[model samples]
Target: MTATGAGQAYGIEALNVWCGLARLTAADLFAGRGLDPERLDNLMMSERSIGLPIEDPVTNAVNAARPLIEALPPEERARIELVVTSTESGVDYSKSLTSYVHKYLGLNRHCRLIEVKQACFGATAAVQTAVGYLASGISPGAKALVIATDVAVVDEKAEYSEPAAGHGAAAMLLSDRPRVLAMDLGAFGNYSYETLDSARPSPRFDIADVDRSLFAYLDCLKNAYADYAARVTDVDFTRDFDHLVMHTPFAGLVKAGHRKMMREQGVTGPRIDEDFARRVAPSLIYPGAVGNLCSGSVYLALASLLDSGVVTAPSRVGLFSYGSGCSSEFFSGIVDEQSAATVAEQGIGKRLEARARITFDEYLAVLEHNLECLVPVENRTVDPAEWEPLLDRVGDRPEILTFTGVKDYHRQYAWR
Candidate 1:
């Protein structure tokens, strides 16, 4: 059965998203170690060596969500109904990182909080859940906060998954008023097996064959889209959306999926007009630069379009989210006016432009540093001159302190 809903009063209002590199480009990695640049150069030229930037997923999630929380009027902040975080970057196996986020961001103490795990589609699920909550009249006039974050770590030993991976984060604030668009959820399907561990390592921790994973993904895409088409009605797939925002694990896959969808739906000629190119032009393919952030990838792209002004209120946006092991969903929504303006004015575009590009060697250094042993101590002092106040920490953690850092990890902050 298909799930469908329409509402002019509920939609996404504003999104504060951020992308960054904790270190440098991957090309610099070989240079820093005095390794042969010839091999690296050849790799880059062949399209196999393009490396995405590395950022701490936790930090990115926190950073992206901070602005949204801070921008909320004080009265609204106190009434937040939910905080949903989607990630593949949880710090510990047992802990729900959302709890830490709630504590750090000073969200309402009464908030209903949870984490979502469905590969890259987790946040989309959260968005759908928020809609259901609103539809059920559970949180009247209250807002739902959704955040997606991940650091794509390429498995060096894997040949196929390397080129397409990256890292990044995105955040969205959904409320009942000032609705931007109507959301309709379509066919959902999942393919599972006891032995499929291609996208991730097995519990015993062995890398499954990359080719097997790729083939499975292709098959899953075909199946999911076919199901979605058969199920959706009253919307012409070809003419309705000016854009199709597919969950991109890599740049090429998105194109493949779009082509497949068009071919299957029998769309052609003027019907396929310039809107296709214009809509897809702003496609957010951060994974090529940020790696695969799992749940955050698709939403990050949506935020990118909103932040860049490619999408405005009343625009119909098509979103396709996929999760490996494996589930897929196709959904569409319209943008709201005030939300669009708030997003445009929030300076997200500026923040993305302000990021510093690092060399491969530098990125490796940061990763190594992060992985390396550090002196453990409590009550670390942050340089007030370096850190800026991103959020007001509430509750019983030692009094909060502010410090400066590169807005996206160029600098470091320690709570004093």
Candidate 2:
């Protein structure tokens, strides 16, 4: 009963996705570490299951949201006033992806749907907006579902890109009363002029370029810490929060930022380092292992943290969301003890552990797959076990189910 009362507020529930990591069998990553040929075959099969267009990050996100929304109770589902989709991958220039999701999910025709575009910070912005909507008294039993999903496909030939490319999605149900925690919207962080260059072009379609050097990233963290320190005078930075959730593009980057912030602020304590290691560090390992999922990356990390029991009710949680247009936001929330146990039991850990790992070669094959085709042929076979029949059609109309194997060296799809 810490501040938000005994009823549920905003909370995240189930998450589902098709990622590069989900393509391999358990033996691939855990047992053989991607060496077994059988595991590789399975990986190839998985890549061929969804079809070429499904290989992209945005498609994975959009597909994942469909079932999640469908699973909600009618009453709860109807209460959703908005559907916010955060993504960097978009094929449409004019229409918002949220509109597509809205139509696909068969949501209330009058509900507001929007796509937020602040790089990785988009979902966080959506979450903040949901909180405001709840506070504003728009509808009784009002709720908002924020979905973040992405597929990070990196070019193997790229020098700077990590081999850990992946794809996944997460869904959060936001409301008032008896939930994870009451969100505390605090002051926003400022961006530095030098940080603007972080988003440079790369051979890989998924990864973004970091503008600052290691030192510069640290310097930005120091600036962020200073900004936070100036606003909140009462809470102890180290002990107040159970864990600090960070925007982790990579594991080492977050650790480096934390060390720099602690050093510059002259705040040295065992609790700080302990918190950084035991809580913060582990929270980010999912991203390191799975590659960056763009907008979905941070929320995926948050789900991992909650799953591991590193975060609990009544504990304060600090969240740092950074988007490489170089904007960042620092906020905190207090977990509600009532629903903490329930929400934490949502089984995100099992889902993460259940992912399949593909080899570097298979990943390359997946990346090379072509998506812009109207017809399918027998030569389109990539993997027999994984491919689904596709329908060929004219214009933007839904095509007929034709060829059934992998095309363009990628997976093929079949409609139900």
Q: Which candidate wins on TM-score?
A: 1
- Give per-residue lDDT, candidate 1, residue 328: 67
lDDT of 2 by residue, 217-297 (tens): 556555665576566655455556677777766565677677666665576767557757775865665565455566666
- Model 1 misplacement above 4 A: 1-4, 21-55, 178-181, 185-197, 202-209, 267-276, 285-289, 307-313, 336-339, 370-416
Whole-model lDDT, candidate 1?
0.57
Q: How many steric clashes does model 2 contain?
A: 17
Model 2 scores a C-alpha lDDT of 0.54
TM-score, one value per model: 0.75, 0.73
Cand. 1 TM to true fold: 0.75
Superposed Cα deviation of residue 410, candidate 1 (Å)? 24
